[model samples]
Target chain A: MFIKIDFQSETPIYLQLRNQIIEGIAKGHFKPNDSLPSVRQLASDIGINLHTINKAYNLLKSENYIAIDRRKGATVLPLMDEPDMAFVDDLKKTLNTLIASSICKGISKDDFLTICSKIYDNFREEM
Target chain B: MFIKIDFQSETPIYLQLRNQIIEGIAKGHFKPNDSLPSVRQLASDIGINLHTINKAYNLLKSENYIAIDRRKGATVLPLMDEPDMAFVDDLKKTLNTLIASSICKGISKDDFLTICSKIYDNFREEM
Candidate 1:
């Protein structure tokens, strides 16, 4: 996968890399159990700092988005068997905050839901 | 409004203040053109640093969420005349990233949409 980093965005490079990798997972670019390129390889391939790629990978690992092996490096984790209660709580809090901002911006509830539905479907479960 | 600060959370205090005020607007606790407490007054009231409140208010100002006046201090702006295209674009990007993480966590699309619908309607338009 060609990871595009927006040099001009104010967002830190590691976070951009993190979000894109999560996006890649959602878009089925990296299937369950798929092996991601090694940190060194990805760094050289994209001209990003090795530290940046490592940070992104570590974040993904901590989030349970990926698992790292001693020798095998990084691999995508299978979807959780049950939805995590903690994760759901965090999701509600986040969505609530985002919806509040959207409401203040005059976005109708329907408009917000339409966007949510569209994005959810954009990540079709090809598993 | 009684503002609560969770120092334990990693979220910055300023952004938390910003989100709470936006939540206040959505919940109708703050009406259109409602005058917010002056920086000094709110800082004293909430026991937060004046600089933190100032940062939050300035951010709100930049987002068109509030207006600052020489005499009035700060006031909530009326809902946008029309949705800002840039804001909608940002909304899409943020939602896309969030929804991706949800999908990876075994959150079915239906479950995700239901959450969105619930949060959206939770902010009833009392205007």
Candidate 2:
């Protein structure tokens, strides 16, 4: 339930919040059906505007990472079983840029894959 | 030297242009020291403002992906030998979000690594 915000970053606060929440879920810090802090509580905890927290929640909801209800508030959703083609395409485009930059930096394919595997393994440790 | 612009994308035109150029380099469509179209020409070709193209070029220059000179216009820079920590950190963060989503989608480690290797090999074909 800890979200760190860097005010100096060029990235918007709401996007940062959303990313961290997603990362938190990936790290197993927030399991499926886990309740997130209410908008007022999170805003107070993070010392940010309530609307900013609301925006982040709405975005997460739109992406199917979480759901909000009038009686229960906001909670994490179980991971979707079906693959999202749109997300896969978007991920490939992003990976292309990172791979391009790594190539420019003289990083070999083996080394890059090693790094990716190592990072992925770190997440598995949490599970 | 063809750059396709998607007007409906949520991504900014300048950023899309920058990414496509980087991907072009990875795909060997543009090689080391290759000259890019002048800002005016590209702007006219893409039907966007000159300043947008200028912004993208400046960003590329700042990232060391390309260099701009008064006489030479803009040209791709040779790959750097040393790794950039800041860039690596940024890439790791992005990859984390991607890995998170992939895990949620039930993509296995082997599948993910296979995809990475295949994409890397595709880039190598250009060389």
User: How well is each residue in A1-127 modelled by candidate 2, as lDDT tens digits?
Assistant: 6899999999999999998888788778889999999999999999999999999999999988899998788999886666688877767777887888788777788888988898889889998
> Please, what is the whole-model Cα lDDT of each candidate in the order they appear?
0.88, 0.86
Scored by lDDT, the top model is 1
List each candidate's DockQ score.
0.78, 0.65
- In Å, residue A51's CA in model 1 sits off its true spot by 1.4
For DockQ, the strongest prediction is 1
lDDT of model 1, residue A46:
89
Off by over 4 Å in 2: none
Please tell me the interface RMSD, in Å, for model 2.
Answer: 1.7
Predicted candidate 2 versus true structure: per-residue lDDT over B9-88, tens digit per residue? 99999999988888887777888999999999999988899999999999999988999999999999887777788877
- Error (Å) of candidate 2 at residue B71 is 0.8
